[model samples]
Target: MKYQGSCHCGQVAYEVDGQLDGAMACNCSICQRKGSLMWFVPRDQLTLLTPESQMATYTFNKHVIQHHFCPTCGIHPFGEGSDPKGNRMAAVNVRCLEGIDLEAVPVKHFDGRAL
Candidate 1:
Protein backbone atom coordinates (compact mmCIF):
# COMPACT_ATOMS: atom_id res chain seq x y z
CA MET A 1 0.00 0.00 0.00
CA LYS A 2 1.69 3.17 -1.16
CA TYR A 3 0.61 6.43 0.42
CA GLN A 4 1.63 10.01 -0.09
CA GLY A 5 2.08 12.51 2.74
CA SER A 6 2.99 16.13 3.10
CA CYS A 7 3.71 18.67 5.78
CA HIS A 8 1.12 21.15 6.98
CA CYS A 9 2.45 23.80 4.63
CA GLY A 10 2.94 21.29 1.82
CA GLN A 11 6.59 22.19 1.64
CA VAL A 12 7.62 18.70 2.56
CA ALA A 13 6.17 15.74 0.67
CA TYR A 14 6.95 12.04 0.56
CA GLU A 15 5.64 8.63 -0.49
CA VAL A 16 5.85 5.43 1.51
CA ASP A 17 5.41 1.82 0.40
CA GLY A 18 4.26 -1.32 2.23
CA GLN A 19 1.32 -1.69 4.61
CA LEU A 20 1.82 0.14 7.84
CA ASP A 21 3.11 -2.66 10.04
CA GLY A 22 1.17 -1.28 13.02
CA ALA A 23 0.57 1.95 14.80
CA MET A 24 2.80 2.64 17.79
CA ALA A 25 1.63 4.74 20.67
CA CYS A 26 4.69 5.60 22.68
CA ASN A 27 4.18 6.59 26.31
CA CYS A 28 7.24 8.82 26.45
CA SER A 29 6.60 12.43 27.43
CA ILE A 30 7.41 13.65 23.93
CA CYS A 31 5.32 10.93 22.28
CA GLN A 32 2.48 11.56 24.67
CA ARG A 33 2.60 15.26 23.99
CA LYS A 34 3.05 14.79 20.25
CA GLY A 35 0.29 12.13 20.16
CA SER A 36 1.57 10.68 16.91
CA LEU A 37 0.80 7.12 15.87
CA MET A 38 3.76 5.57 14.07
CA TRP A 39 4.77 2.69 11.83
CA PHE A 40 8.06 1.17 10.69
CA VAL A 41 9.72 1.31 7.29
CA PRO A 42 13.10 1.10 5.67
CA ARG A 43 14.83 4.38 4.84
CA ASP A 44 14.87 3.35 1.18
CA GLN A 45 11.09 3.17 1.04
CA LEU A 46 10.68 6.89 1.63
CA THR A 47 11.39 9.58 -0.92
CA LEU A 48 11.91 13.14 0.22
CA LEU A 49 10.98 16.02 -2.02
CA THR A 50 13.61 18.24 -0.46
CA PRO A 51 17.18 17.52 0.34
CA GLU A 52 18.62 17.36 3.88
CA SER A 53 18.98 21.15 3.71
CA GLN A 54 15.20 21.50 3.71
CA MET A 55 14.65 19.65 6.96
CA ALA A 56 15.41 20.38 10.58
CA THR A 57 16.46 17.67 13.00
CA TYR A 58 15.47 17.59 16.65
CA THR A 59 16.72 15.31 19.38
CA PHE A 60 16.24 15.14 23.13
CA ASN A 61 16.82 13.03 26.24
CA LYS A 62 18.18 9.63 25.19
CA HIS A 63 18.71 11.15 21.76
CA VAL A 64 18.01 7.92 19.93
CA ILE A 65 15.24 8.93 17.57
CA GLN A 66 16.17 11.58 15.03
CA HIS A 67 13.02 13.68 14.61
CA HIS A 68 13.03 15.42 11.27
CA PHE A 69 10.53 18.12 10.42
CA CYS A 70 10.08 20.72 7.76
CA PRO A 71 11.97 23.90 8.55
CA THR A 72 9.21 26.11 7.20
CA CYS A 73 6.47 24.27 9.08
CA GLY A 74 6.90 22.68 12.45
CA ILE A 75 4.86 19.67 11.43
CA HIS A 76 6.73 16.40 11.99
CA PRO A 77 6.12 14.16 9.00
CA PHE A 78 8.27 11.23 10.04
CA GLY A 79 11.32 10.24 12.06
CA GLU A 80 14.44 8.18 11.49
CA GLY A 81 16.32 5.86 13.85
CA SER A 82 14.63 3.62 16.41
CA ASP A 83 17.67 2.17 18.15
CA PRO A 84 20.09 3.96 20.37
CA LYS A 85 22.97 2.86 18.18
CA GLY A 86 21.38 4.45 15.11
CA ASN A 87 21.05 1.59 12.71
CA ARG A 88 18.76 1.27 9.66
CA MET A 89 15.07 1.96 10.35
CA ALA A 90 12.46 4.66 10.19
CA ALA A 91 9.45 5.59 12.33
CA VAL A 92 6.77 7.05 10.11
CA ASN A 93 3.99 9.09 11.66
CA VAL A 94 0.59 7.64 10.82
CA ARG A 95 -1.00 11.08 10.99
CA CYS A 96 0.94 12.02 7.88
CA LEU A 97 -0.43 9.08 5.91
CA GLU A 98 -3.15 9.66 3.32
CA GLY A 99 -6.27 7.53 2.76
CA ILE A 100 -5.56 5.30 5.71
CA ASP A 101 -8.19 3.55 7.80
CA LEU A 102 -6.82 4.24 11.27
CA GLU A 103 -9.50 2.15 12.98
CA ALA A 104 -8.61 -1.02 11.08
CA VAL A 105 -4.88 -0.73 11.75
CA PRO A 106 -3.23 -2.63 14.58
CA VAL A 107 -1.86 -0.47 17.37
CA LYS A 108 0.79 -1.18 19.97
CA HIS A 109 1.64 0.79 23.09
CA PHE A 110 5.24 1.46 23.99
CA ASP A 111 6.41 2.76 27.37
CA GLY A 112 8.36 5.54 25.73
CA ARG A 113 7.16 8.50 27.75
CA ALA A 114 8.38 6.43 30.67
CA LEU A 115 11.67 5.64 28.96
Candidate 2:
Protein backbone atom coordinates (compact mmCIF):
# COMPACT_ATOMS: atom_id res chain seq x y z
CA MET A 1 0.00 0.00 0.00
CA LYS A 2 1.03 3.57 -0.65
CA TYR A 3 0.87 6.25 2.03
CA GLN A 4 1.19 10.03 1.73
CA GLY A 5 2.80 11.98 4.55
CA SER A 6 4.26 15.37 5.34
CA CYS A 7 5.38 17.66 8.09
CA HIS A 8 2.80 19.62 10.04
CA CYS A 9 3.09 22.59 7.72
CA GLY A 10 3.39 20.45 4.58
CA GLN A 11 6.83 21.84 3.78
CA VAL A 12 8.20 18.33 3.73
CA ALA A 13 6.08 15.80 1.89
CA TYR A 14 6.62 12.23 0.74
CA GLU A 15 5.03 9.05 -0.54
CA VAL A 16 5.94 5.66 0.86
CA ASP A 17 4.97 2.23 -0.46
CA GLY A 18 4.77 -0.83 1.79
CA GLN A 19 2.69 -2.84 4.17
CA LEU A 20 2.37 -1.33 7.65
CA ASP A 21 1.95 -4.47 9.68
CA GLY A 22 2.77 -2.51 12.83
CA ALA A 23 4.59 0.54 14.11
CA MET A 24 7.50 0.79 16.46
CA ALA A 25 7.37 3.15 19.39
CA CYS A 26 10.95 3.71 20.42
CA ASN A 27 11.81 4.93 23.89
CA CYS A 28 14.92 6.86 23.00
CA SER A 29 15.55 10.49 23.86
CA ILE A 30 14.38 11.96 20.58
CA CYS A 31 11.79 9.31 19.88
CA GLN A 32 10.33 9.72 23.32
CA ARG A 33 10.04 13.46 22.94
CA LYS A 34 8.69 13.40 19.40
CA GLY A 35 6.19 10.61 20.04
CA SER A 36 6.33 9.13 16.55
CA LEU A 37 5.05 5.74 15.55
CA MET A 38 7.42 4.42 12.90
CA TRP A 39 6.87 2.13 9.96
CA PHE A 40 9.99 0.82 8.28
CA VAL A 41 10.42 0.35 4.53
CA PRO A 42 13.18 0.14 1.99
CA ARG A 43 14.62 3.52 0.98
CA ASP A 44 13.68 2.82 -2.64
CA GLN A 45 10.06 2.50 -1.62
CA LEU A 46 9.96 6.09 -0.41
CA THR A 47 9.57 9.03 -2.80
CA LEU A 48 10.12 12.62 -1.75
CA LEU A 49 7.30 14.88 -2.87
CA THR A 50 9.06 18.08 -1.96
CA PRO A 51 12.56 19.44 -2.18
CA GLU A 52 14.90 17.71 0.20
CA SER A 53 16.46 21.06 1.02
CA GLN A 54 13.17 22.15 2.53
CA MET A 55 13.67 19.77 5.39
CA ALA A 56 16.28 19.74 8.15
CA THR A 57 18.24 16.65 9.11
CA TYR A 58 19.33 15.73 12.61
CA THR A 59 21.54 12.94 13.88
CA PHE A 60 22.82 11.92 17.26
CA ASN A 61 24.23 9.06 19.32
CA LYS A 62 25.83 6.65 16.80
CA HIS A 63 24.69 9.08 14.08
CA VAL A 64 23.52 6.31 11.81
CA ILE A 65 20.02 7.61 11.15
CA GLN A 66 19.21 10.88 9.44
CA HIS A 67 16.03 12.18 11.02
CA HIS A 68 14.26 14.54 8.64
CA PHE A 69 11.93 17.25 9.79
CA CYS A 70 10.41 20.50 8.62
CA PRO A 71 12.18 23.60 9.89
CA THR A 72 9.04 25.67 9.74
CA CYS A 73 6.72 23.27 11.50
CA GLY A 74 9.34 21.38 13.40
CA ILE A 75 7.63 18.11 12.61
CA HIS A 76 9.58 14.94 12.03
CA PRO A 77 8.00 13.03 9.15
CA PHE A 78 10.56 10.37 8.46
CA GLY A 79 14.10 9.13 8.93
CA GLU A 80 16.67 7.28 6.82
CA GLY A 81 19.34 4.76 7.73
CA SER A 82 20.90 1.43 6.86
CA ASP A 83 20.03 -1.93 8.29
CA PRO A 84 22.55 -4.39 9.81
CA LYS A 85 23.25 -5.84 6.34
CA GLY A 86 23.70 -2.31 4.92
CA ASN A 87 20.42 -2.11 3.04
CA ARG A 88 19.12 1.48 2.94
CA MET A 89 15.85 1.95 4.77
CA ALA A 90 13.33 4.62 5.62
CA ALA A 91 11.38 4.92 8.86
CA VAL A 92 8.13 6.64 8.11
CA ASN A 93 6.31 8.35 10.97
CA VAL A 94 2.87 6.86 10.82
CA ARG A 95 1.59 9.80 12.87
CA CYS A 96 2.38 12.07 9.94
CA LEU A 97 0.63 9.93 7.35
CA GLU A 98 -2.70 10.81 5.78
CA GLY A 99 -6.01 9.00 6.01
CA ILE A 100 -5.07 6.01 8.08
CA ASP A 101 -6.70 4.36 11.04
CA LEU A 102 -3.90 4.77 13.51
CA GLU A 103 -5.96 2.97 16.15
CA ALA A 104 -6.03 -0.16 14.02
CA VAL A 105 -2.29 -0.44 13.71
CA PRO A 106 -0.62 -2.48 16.42
CA VAL A 107 2.36 -0.89 18.06
CA LYS A 108 5.50 -2.58 19.34
CA HIS A 109 7.69 -0.86 21.88
CA PHE A 110 11.42 -0.62 21.28
CA ASP A 111 13.92 0.03 24.03
CA GLY A 112 16.16 2.35 22.01
CA ARG A 113 17.50 3.90 25.18
CA ALA A 114 19.21 0.62 26.00
CA LEU A 115 21.10 0.57 22.72
Candidate 3:
Protein backbone atom coordinates (compact mmCIF):
# COMPACT_ATOMS: atom_id res chain seq x y z
CA MET A 1 0.00 0.00 0.00
CA LYS A 2 1.07 3.56 -0.60
CA TYR A 3 0.81 6.23 2.09
CA GLN A 4 1.15 10.01 1.88
CA GLY A 5 2.72 11.93 4.71
CA SER A 6 3.96 15.43 5.52
CA CYS A 7 5.16 17.61 8.29
CA HIS A 8 2.76 19.61 10.46
CA CYS A 9 3.00 22.68 8.23
CA GLY A 10 3.23 20.61 5.06
CA GLN A 11 6.70 21.85 4.31
CA VAL A 12 7.99 18.32 4.06
CA ALA A 13 5.94 15.75 2.14
CA TYR A 14 6.51 12.25 0.86
CA GLU A 15 4.95 9.05 -0.48
CA VAL A 16 5.93 5.67 0.84
CA ASP A 17 4.97 2.18 -0.36
CA GLY A 18 4.56 -0.51 2.26
CA GLN A 19 2.17 -2.55 4.36
CA LEU A 20 2.20 -1.15 7.84
CA ASP A 21 1.92 -4.23 9.98
CA GLY A 22 2.88 -2.35 13.11
CA ALA A 23 4.88 0.55 14.48
CA MET A 24 7.75 0.89 16.91
CA ALA A 25 7.78 3.18 19.87
CA CYS A 26 11.32 3.81 20.97
CA ASN A 27 12.24 4.95 24.45
CA CYS A 28 15.37 6.79 23.35
CA SER A 29 15.78 10.39 24.44
CA ILE A 30 14.66 11.91 21.15
CA CYS A 31 12.05 9.24 20.37
CA GLN A 32 10.53 9.53 23.82
CA ARG A 33 10.22 13.29 23.55
CA LYS A 34 9.02 13.37 19.94
CA GLY A 35 6.40 10.66 20.46
CA SER A 36 6.68 9.23 16.96
CA LEU A 37 5.32 5.84 15.93
CA MET A 38 7.71 4.53 13.28
CA TRP A 39 6.92 2.15 10.44
CA PHE A 40 10.00 0.78 8.75
CA VAL A 41 10.27 0.30 5.01
CA PRO A 42 12.94 0.04 2.34
CA ARG A 43 14.46 3.41 1.43
CA ASP A 44 13.62 2.84 -2.22
CA GLN A 45 9.96 2.54 -1.30
CA LEU A 46 9.85 6.14 -0.20
CA THR A 47 9.56 9.10 -2.57
CA LEU A 48 9.97 12.70 -1.60
CA LEU A 49 7.19 15.05 -2.66
CA THR A 50 8.80 18.21 -1.45
CA PRO A 51 12.19 19.77 -1.95
CA GLU A 52 14.92 18.30 0.21
CA SER A 53 16.22 21.78 0.90
CA GLN A 54 13.11 22.52 2.89
CA MET A 55 13.97 19.87 5.42
CA ALA A 56 16.72 19.52 8.01
CA THR A 57 18.58 16.46 9.21
CA TYR A 58 19.56 15.47 12.69
CA THR A 59 21.51 12.57 14.11
CA PHE A 60 22.86 11.54 17.47
CA ASN A 61 24.30 8.67 19.50
CA LYS A 62 26.07 6.41 16.98
CA HIS A 63 24.87 8.81 14.22
CA VAL A 64 23.72 5.97 12.05
CA ILE A 65 20.24 7.34 11.37
CA GLN A 66 19.54 10.61 9.61
CA HIS A 67 16.33 11.98 11.03
CA HIS A 68 14.67 14.35 8.60
CA PHE A 69 12.31 17.07 9.72
CA CYS A 70 10.61 20.18 8.42
CA PRO A 71 12.38 23.25 9.66
CA THR A 72 9.29 25.40 9.31
CA CYS A 73 7.07 23.10 11.33
CA GLY A 74 9.71 21.33 13.31
CA ILE A 75 8.05 18.01 12.55
CA HIS A 76 9.98 14.81 11.93
CA PRO A 77 8.28 12.94 9.14
CA PHE A 78 10.86 10.24 8.46
CA GLY A 79 14.36 8.99 9.00
CA GLU A 80 16.96 7.07 6.98
CA GLY A 81 19.39 4.41 8.10
CA SER A 82 20.76 0.98 7.32
CA ASP A 83 19.85 -2.34 8.84
CA PRO A 84 22.33 -4.79 10.37
CA LYS A 85 23.06 -6.25 6.96
CA GLY A 86 23.51 -2.75 5.47
CA ASN A 87 20.26 -2.56 3.53
CA ARG A 88 19.01 1.01 3.45
CA MET A 89 15.79 1.62 5.37
CA ALA A 90 13.39 4.43 6.00
CA ALA A 91 11.58 4.96 9.26
CA VAL A 92 8.30 6.66 8.49
CA ASN A 93 6.50 8.38 11.28
CA VAL A 94 3.00 6.95 11.14
CA ARG A 95 1.73 9.85 13.17
CA CYS A 96 2.62 12.14 10.27
CA LEU A 97 0.80 10.02 7.74
CA GLU A 98 -2.59 10.99 6.34
CA GLY A 99 -5.86 9.15 7.00
CA ILE A 100 -4.27 6.36 8.97
CA ASP A 101 -6.17 4.49 11.65
CA LEU A 102 -3.76 4.85 14.50
CA GLU A 103 -5.77 2.43 16.64
CA ALA A 104 -5.60 -0.33 14.07
CA VAL A 105 -1.80 -0.46 14.03
CA PRO A 106 -0.20 -2.40 16.83
CA VAL A 107 2.85 -0.84 18.47
CA LYS A 108 5.91 -2.58 19.83
CA HIS A 109 7.93 -0.80 22.47
CA PHE A 110 11.68 -0.67 21.84
CA ASP A 111 14.20 -0.29 24.60
CA GLY A 112 16.34 2.18 22.62
CA ARG A 113 17.56 3.76 25.83
CA ALA A 114 19.39 0.56 26.59
CA LEU A 115 21.10 0.40 23.22
Please provide, for model 3 over 1-115, each residue's C-alpha lDDT reduced to its tens digit, 9 standing for 90 to 100. 9999999999999999989999999999999999999999999999999989999999998899999999888999999999999999999999999999999999999999998
Model 3: lDDT equals 0.96
**Candidate 1: what lDDT?**
0.81
Cα lDDT tens digits, model 1, 1-115, are 7888877887778888877768898988777887888888877888887676777889998676788888897888889884545557778888888788889889999986554
**CA-lDDT, candidates in order:** 0.81, 0.96, 0.96
**Model 1: residues >4 Å from true position, as ranges?**
82-86
Q: Which residue runs does candidate 2 get wrong by more than 4 Å? A: none
Off by over 4 Å in 3: none
lDDT of 2 at 99: 96
Q: Indicate the worst ten consecutive residues by lDDT in candidate 1.
A: 81-90
Candidate 3 residue-wise lDDT at 107: 100
lDDT of 2 by residue, 70-95 (tens): 99999999999999999999999999
Instruction: Tell me the TM-score of each prediction against the true structure.
Output: 0.86, 0.98, 0.98
